[model samples]
Target chain A: MSDKPESLTQADESALMQLREEIDRLDTEILALISKRANCAMKVAEVKMKASGNAGAVFYRPEREAQVLTSVMDRNPGPLGNEDMAKLFREIMSACLALEKPMEVAYLGPEGTFTQQAALKHFGQWVKTKPMPAIDEVFREVEAGACNYGVVPVENSSEGIVNHTLDTFITSNIKICGEVELRIHHHLLAGPNTKHDKISRIYSHQQSLAQCRKWLDAHMPHAERIAVSSNAEAAKRVQGEWNSAAIAGELAASLYDLEIVESKIEDSPDNSTRFLIIGTEQVGPSSEDKTSLVVSMRNEPGALYHLLKPFNEFGVDMTRLETRPSMTGNWTYVFFIDFAGHCEDESAIKVINAIRETAVDVKVLGSYPKGVL
Target chain B: MSDKPESLTQADESALMQLREEIDRLDTEILALISKRANCAMKVAEVKMKASGNAGAVFYRPEREAQVLTSVMDRNPGPLGNEDMAKLFREIMSACLALEKPMEVAYLGPEGTFTQQAALKHFGQWVKTKPMPAIDEVFREVEAGACNYGVVPVENSSEGIVNHTLDTFITSNIKICGEVELRIHHHLLAGPNTKHDKISRIYSHQQSLAQCRKWLDAHMPHAERIAVSSNAEAAKRVQGEWNSAAIAGELAASLYDLEIVESKIEDSPDNSTRFLIIGTEQVGPSSEDKTSLVVSMRNEPGALYHLLKPFNEFGVDMTRLETRPSMTGNWTYVFFIDFAGHCEDESAIKVINAIRETAVDVKVLGSYPKGVL
Candidate 1:
C-alpha cells in the first residue's frame, strides 16, 4: 500500500537530461523565428499605412492569412499531423498580425459563448475580443469603427443557421472578411462545493441543452433543465449555486472556476458551428474561397429552378441555399446562397450576370477565404 | 375630464338587447355543429379501430387535418382573415380529435418553450402534453408508445435548423406526421413590483437574447444579460426577482404570472420557427405537401450540382438544401433537402431516383402536409 516514487538509474537520468536540454535548444530557435516574423509584420504595417495615406489601414488581411495557413499545412513535414502543425503556425501568425496592428473583435456574448471561442480560434489570442449583447451590435461595432472586426455565428451543424446574422447583413453594409468553423463540444460543469449526487438542476443555452439532451436524459433525468442566454452565463449562474450544474465548454469551466462533471456531451459527434468574420473591407481570393450572395427572385412558377441554373451551367459548387421571406412584399422570398469560388473569377462573373438577368435583384455579400481551422 | 359616463338611451338599450339575443342564438347553432363534428370523429375512430382489429388505431391524420384547415380557410367568408377563421376551426378540429382519442404528446420542455407552444398550436389545447428534458426523449416517448406523438423544432426562419432533431432522425424510425410554423414574438416581462429603471439584469434563452438584441441595447443598455434554458424558464426565474426582467413569449408570461414590460421585442419582424410532429404512422398527401430527405453525397467535383440538377429537370421545386459533415468519413457531407411535393408524386419519384443514381444514400425523412397555420 506504500506510495513511493521509483528512482531511475544514473544512465537513464543522464539521457533524460540530454533530451530536455535539446528541447530547450529547439524552443530557443523557434522563439527567434517568431520574433523575426513579428518584426517583418510591423514593417509591412508601416508600408500599408504609408500607401493608404492614413492610420486607418487594414492590417489583418484574411486572404493573405488563409494563404499562409494553407501553405503551412501543405508543406508540413510533420511528426504532428497537418492540422496540429498549422495550428502552431496559426498562433505565430496571430502574434505577428497583432504586431502589425492591435486588432479588437466584437462577438455575441456574455462572455464564454462558442462565438467567443470561434473568435479566438480564428484570430488567435493576440486580438482583444468584446462581447456584444446581440448579433446586430457585433455588426454595429464593426460598422461604427468601434472594433476592427466582428465575429458572428452564421450556422451550426446541429442547430442550423443563425438568422439574425444573415438578416443583419441585409441591412448593414459590412463585408464578410473571412469564415471559421469550430466543433462545438459541451461539458457538464459544477462548482467545487456541489455534491454530485445532490445535483437538482442543469443550466445551459436552449441549443446547448438540446444538443446534450440525450446525455442529460440518460444521466440526470430528474435534474431540471434550465435554458440560458449563453453557456458562459450558465457557468456563471452555477458558480454561486450548490445544487446545480452547467453545460458549457472547457473555457467556461476555466473562466468560472468550475470542475468538469462530464465532457463532450453533445448528441452529435460532429456538432460544429460556422462563424463569419465581418469587417468593412472585402477580402480577396486565397485560391480556395467562397462567395455568399443574397438574391431576391420574382414570385414565379420556376423562380428557384431559374435561380439555380447558372450555378449548374457554370459548374459552380453551391454549398448552401436558404429561403427567407423578402422584406419587399408578402409571399415574395429571397435566397441566401453560398458557393465555391471568388466572385471575381471568370466563371463566377458569367454566373452572376446570368442570375441578374432572371433575378429581381442580386447582392453579393462577400467573397472570402474558406475556413482553414 | 368630468369622469362621467354617457348612458345609453332606452331605444339604444332595446337594440343592444336584440343584438345580444341574436348572438346567443348563433352561439347555440355553433355549439350544435361542433357537437356533430365530435360525434362524427368518434364514429370515424371506431371504424378505424375495427379495421385495425384493436384499440391501437392511428386516429390522428395530419394530412386530413391539413385538408380541413385548408378548406376552412379557402371557403371562409367573414370579417376575420383566412388565418383567423382557420384558427377557430383548428381548435374545433382539435376538440373533435380529442373526442376520438385522448392523444398525449411529448415535447422539448420545462413548460414555456417555443416547442411546447408549437405542439399546442399543432395539436390544440385538448391533448395532454408531457415535457421531455431533451429532443431524443421526445422521440423515445413516441417510439416507446408512452406518448402517441412528439413535437420537435426542425428549423427556424432566423436561427436555422435544429440539428439535434435531424440527427435524432438518423437513428430513430419516427415518421414526421406533420409540420407547423409559428411566428415567434418575444416580450420583455417582469414581476409586478419590479422598477423598470432599477432593472439590472435580463434573463432569456440565448437565441431570444440575440433576437431581441436591438431592443435591449436601445432600452436597457446597462443590464447584465443572463442566458437560461428556455424563455419560460427565464420568466420563472424573473418571477421572484424584483430587479430583473425576462425576454419571453406571451405564453411564458401568463404561465409564470409575469407582466409584459414590452411586447413583440424580437429584432426581426418576420421571425418564425418551423416544428415537426413525429409519430409511428405515415401521413398521406394533402395535395399540398412537402417532402424532407437526408441525402449523403460522395466527395467529388460538382456533387452538389449533380444532386440538384435532377430536382430542376423533374420540376420538383426545392425549398431548402442544407449541408452537414457526414458521420462516415472526413470531407464527406450529407444534405437535408426540402421540396414542394410528396414522396409519392411522379416528379418527386423521378427526382429521388435520379438522385439515387449519384448520391451515396437518400433517406426519406417524411412526406408530410405543409404547415397550414
Candidate 2:
C-alpha cells in the first residue's frame, strides 16, 4: 500500500514537471512570434512612409488594431478574458512602434510632469526625450534640429486651454505634427525617513494642490500648503523630512528616492490633458487628418462674423479656435483655428484665400495626419 | 507741493477703485452673456435630443467650439492674447454645460484616487459624485440606479489596459455612456507633526508604485514599499502614524490632514489615463458618433476572416477590436469592437448583420455620440 502511494506521488510530480516544461516552451515560442510580428510592423511603417513621402510617419492604424484584438479574442480559449488578450496586443503594438523609430521628443518639463507623459504616449519608449523649461523652449528644440518633435499641453479637459502653448504656436515656425490625449492623475508622496505624526508642511505645484481643494478642505483643514516651482522640485525638497511631503507623480518618487505614501489621489478620475506635437517636417497623408491655421483680423465689430462665413459656405469643419494678442499692433488679435481637411486640398486653399481677404494676417500652421490613439 | 502730492495719490487711488469697478461690471456682463449662451445651448441640446430620440445626448460640437474660439480671438482688443481669450471661452462653455445638466457620477474609491480626478474633468464641479468600493461596484451602482453613470479606468498610456473594468463589461448590461481622459500625478504626503528623517515606510496602491518603479529604484532605494487598497486608505493610515507617509493625490493631503512632502512624482510627465462612463442609458447622434458591439464565434478556422470581410467590403470603418474568452463554452471566444458611424446608418447595419451571420452571438453595446474635445 505504501509503495503504491509513493508511485502515485511520483507520477503527479512528473506530470507537474512536464506541464512546466510545456509552458516554458510555449513562452519561448510566443516571444519569438512577438519579435517577428514587431519586425513586420516596422516593415509596414516603411511602406507607409514611402507611399506618403514622409520617412517617419506613424503607420499603425487604431482601426486595424481593433480588428486584430477582436480576432485574438475570438480565438482565445480560457480563464483570460477578451480584454486581457486585447491589452496584451496594445502593449505589443506600443513596443513595436518604439522599435520602428527611436523618436527624439522635447516637452515642457523639469521631468515627471504631465507633458512628459504625453510625449511618451504619443512617441512611445522608442523615442529619446529632452526636457525643456518652458513651452517656447519645446518649440525651439523642435525648430532648431535638437529634436524630431516637441510635445506641449494645448488643453486640459477640466481646466481648459493651455494659453502658453497656443501663444507659442502663434509665433513659432514649428508645425502641428500630431496630437496625443492623456488622462491626468495626481498623487501625494513623501520621503522614507519621515514620521507621519510630526508633519507640519506640505509642498506641491499650485495647480496640483488646487485640483484637490475639495478633498483638502474635508481632511486636512489645518496643514499649511506651500507652492513650489514644479512637482519634481517639491519631491526633491521632501528628501529628508518626516513631517513634510509633496504632491507629485511617480517620477518624483523614483527620482527623489522617496516612497509613495498614497496613490491615484486625484479628486476626479476623468481628468485628461491634450497635447500637440510640434515639428518642422510635415506628416504624410493619413486616412484621417486634421489641419490647423491662424487667421488675424483687424479689430472691428463684424470682422469675426465675416471671417467665419467662409467656413460655413465652404462646409469646412473646424476643431479648435484660439486667440493671441497681435504682437505688432495694440488692441488687435490673431485667431488660431484648427479644422478638419488638409491645406493641400482645393476647398481648404479656397477658404484660406477668402478669409485672407477679410483678415489682416493669415498663416497656415501646418496640416498633418491626426493621431488615432 | 504737499497738496499736489496728496492729490496725485488720491487720484491714483480713485483710478484704481474705478478700474476695479469697471472690471467688476465687465465680469457681470460676461456672466450674463455666459448664462444666455448656456440657455441657448440647452435649447440646442433639446433639439438634438428630440431629433435623435435620446434624452442625454451631447449636442456640443467640437468644430463649432473651434470656430467660436477663432471668432473671439479675431475680434479681441487686447492685452489678453488669442490663446487666453479662447481659454476663457472654453471654461465658459464648460460652465455652460454644467448649467444645462449637472452630471451625476460614480468612481471606484474611498476617495483621493486617480479616477476621481478624471471624473472631475468630465463633469466639472457642478456634478454630483459618489464613490464605490470596486470597479464592478461602480458598474453595478450605475446599472441599479444608485448613480446616473460610473467612471472606470479603461487603459493607461504606460501600463496598458485596465483588465478589471474591461472584463466586467463583457458580462454587464451597462453601456459606455462617455469617456474622460486624465494625466496622472503622484505625491508624497505626511501628517503635520512627523519629522522627515524619522519616516521609515511608504504606502500606496500597487499600480501607482509600479508606474513609479524607475523613480523609486533611483531615489528611495532603502525604504520599504507598501501597497494598500487606495491612496485614500494610505492617507487615512498615515494620520495615526508619524513614521509613515502616503503616496496619493492632493485630496489626500486635505483628507487625512497630511502635508505634501513631494509633488508630480509620476515616471512620465505625460502619464494620462482614459476612463469610460458606464450607464444603462444609450447615447444619441451628433455631428460625429462611434458605435461599440460584441460578437462571439465558435472554434472554427476562418471565422474571424469572414467576420471582418464585411467591414472591408461594405466600407465600414472600425476603430477598435478586443477579444475575451467565452465563459460558457470551452475553446470559444468573444470579440468587442468599436467603429465609426451609428448602428442606424445603412452601411453599418449591413456590416453588422454580415458579422452576425458568422458569429454565434452578436450584441450591440451601444452607439454613442463621439466626444468633440
The ten-residue window of minimal lDDT in model 1 chain A covers A1-10
Looking at the true structure's interface, with contacts defined as alpha carbon pairs within 8 Å between chains A and B, what fraction does model 2 recover? 0.00
The residue-by-residue lDDT of candidate 2 on A6-36, one tens digit each, is 2234544455345435433433333334444
Compose the digit string of candidate 2's lDDT tens values, residues B115-216. 775765555433567666579999989888778778888876434677778778778899776666777677888888988777788888887777777777
Root mean square deviation (Cα) for candidate 1:
33.8
Estimate candidate 1's alpha-carbon lDDT, on a 0 to 1 scale.
0.77
Candidate 2 residue A168 Cα shift, in angstroms, is 3.1
Docking quality (DockQ) for each candidate: 0.01, 0.01
| Candidate 2 DockQ vs. native | 0.01
Best by lDDT: 1
How do the candidates score on chain B by TM-score? 0.82, 0.65
TM-score of predicted chain A against the true chain A, for each candidate: 0.82, 0.65
Write one digit per residue (lDDT tens) for candidate 1, span A1-373. Answer: 0000123346534553454354334333333333444455665555555545655666777886777778666654433345644554565566667666779999876444678768877887568887676789899999999999899989864345788788888888998989888777778999989999999999988888998889888999999999887777999999999999999876567557788887788888888889999998778778699999999987899999999999999999999999998887876688999999999898999999999999888899999998987
lDDT of 2: 0.66
Off by over 4 Å in 1: A1-373, B1-6, B156-159, B186-263
